[model samples]
Target: MSKLRVAVIGCGAISKHRHIPEYAANPHVELVAFCDPVQERAKHYAGQYGAKAYTDYETLLREVKPDAVSVCTPNALHAPVSIAAAKAGAHVLVEKPMAATEEEALAMIEAAKENGVYLMVGHNQRLMPHHMKAKQILNAGALGKVLTFRTSFGHPGPESWSVDGRDSWFFRKDEAIMGAMGDLGVHKSDLIRWLLDDEVADVAGFIGTLDKAGTDVDDNAACVLRMKSGIIGTLVASWTYYQGGDNGTVLWCENGIMKIDTHPDDQIIVELRNGSIERHKVGAIATNEKQTASGVIDAFVESIVTKTPPSISGEEGMRSLKVILAAFESQATGQVVRL
Candidate 1:
């Protein structure tokens, strides 16, 4: 079988660590081109993966004509780049937060639909095994009504991802949009929505810039979401976390409470009303993404060939981005924003 020719734009940490490696790993994908404004970085990708390198994205799109492209650039550039790829007749897999704003996100979605190309967002959380298990339990009524739940995702900032290290666009309002909210927060928003199978209706929130090394955007975000399913919950996303653990989501029902993360043995633990706790050993999702490093390339390639929507579609990405936007607006206005 001829492999899916893929062009990767942005030779950043995500491209280097996940996308490139995963494409290289997948038999269905042939990494044909790479683009980064930095000539050296593009050349480095070419050298490593035997791909054509271009500093110009349009040139890569026009000449190489890849079957798919990964938009691994900054949050703000997501829409423009993905739209360009879709217009160029390539399926697009854009990184999360989709875009910095709802308008931009919708533009990307529209471009993909207009261009008749498959558009998938880089929300890999939907593929996590433990989270899926928890969702199954909730759906099976093991978690009962799911009255109150608290989900969080935090890290010690994104210095590892910045070309300028801790001084990159991630801290800038003009480029990165919102700090932790755009980066870490969107992941949780996507996760909770997928888990509960509902959209967020209103959010009462608080965001602070406390305890971070960089600027303007808040490194910490805390918000309460009112789900359309009548489940009210709190979501916390922060770039101020220290040490190693990225302690995450907890769902509480009348019968029990469930906690999930990448812990060694007790990755997913459930506490029963009778005080008995059950522990499940869960490994991370395997692919090309920011964290979990899950198999996004494989899925994207499969979708392109099969004419199927990916696990995370552009519409799903738009939905998650809206939640983040609503949270930000709520924080700014001191009034809950309707979605």
Candidate 2:
């Protein structure tokens, strides 16, 4: 089979670390184009992979006509770029938070459906090995029923991870939409929702720029969520974690408690109510410090190749985005916003 020609839009941190490298490593994909407003950034990746570079995504889509496009741009550009690629008959793999608003996300989904192309969101958390195992255990009824949980994602801020450092679009309200909520909260929201196999019915939170001076976007967010199944949980996303990153989730089920990515050696720990403790080292969870193959790129490629819907479809992306949107509404109104 001929390799699927893949183009990556936005050559910054995510593109450099996850999308570009993963596409290059996939045997079924060819790095055919790179697009970024910063010509140098696009050219750097294009040169390395022997692909063409473009400052404008529309031009890249028209010229290369890639089979797949990875939309790694900022939150504000996710909808437009993905829609354009879908209209051009290319499968899309957009970064998390899918879009800045509900309307934008729906439009991207419609465009892909109209063009008969796959629209996958880059929600890598569900694809993690440890997470996959937890899901399996839950499915097997080992945990009985999840009652409540706590999931958090925190780091020293995107300045350390983003290619632009302190001046990165992450801190800007216009570009990033929401800071910690969009960057980190959305990931955990998607993860917890998927883990429990339920949708968020309501949410209440306190979201603000507690630290990180001169930035309009929020740096911290703590929200309370109640799922449709009556499973309650707390989610915390913060960029003010000065010491290190924390990406951990604990599920309190009827039979036992499951802790994930909280221990250094064990990726998963299950403590039963009947005095049983199970420890397993499934795999490493990807973090800013320790980057790993996210499995998103490969999954997107496979969906396109097989002519099937992506695992994290645009609709799935929209549902996850809705949770964050509710959190924002909850913060604004100081009430539990129902989804």
> Which whole-number lDDT from 0 to 100 does residue 20 have in model 1?
89
The worst-scoring run of ten residues by lDDT in candidate 1 lies at 284-293
* Each model's lDDT: 0.84, 0.93
Segments in model 2 whose C-alpha atoms lie over 4 Å from true places: none
Supply every candidate's count of residue pairs whose N, Cα or C atoms clash at under 3 angstroms.
6, 0
Candidate 1 residues lying further than 4 Å off, grouped into runs, are 284-292
Q: Measure candidate 2: CA RMSD.
A: 0.8
Writing each residue's lDDT as its tens digit, candidate 2 over 251-315 gives: 99999999999999999999999998989899888888789999999899889888888989999
> What digit string (tens of lDDT, one per residue) describes model 1 on residues 1-339?
688999999988788777888888887888899998889999998988888989999888999988899999877788889999999999999998898777888888899889899999887777767877878878888667888788887767877656668777787788787788888788889999999888898888799899875487888999999999889999989887766536478888889988877455677888889888888877754422235546577788889888887879988998998888888888889999988
How far out, in Å, is residue 258 in model 1?
1.1
TM-score to native of every candidate shown: 0.94, 0.99
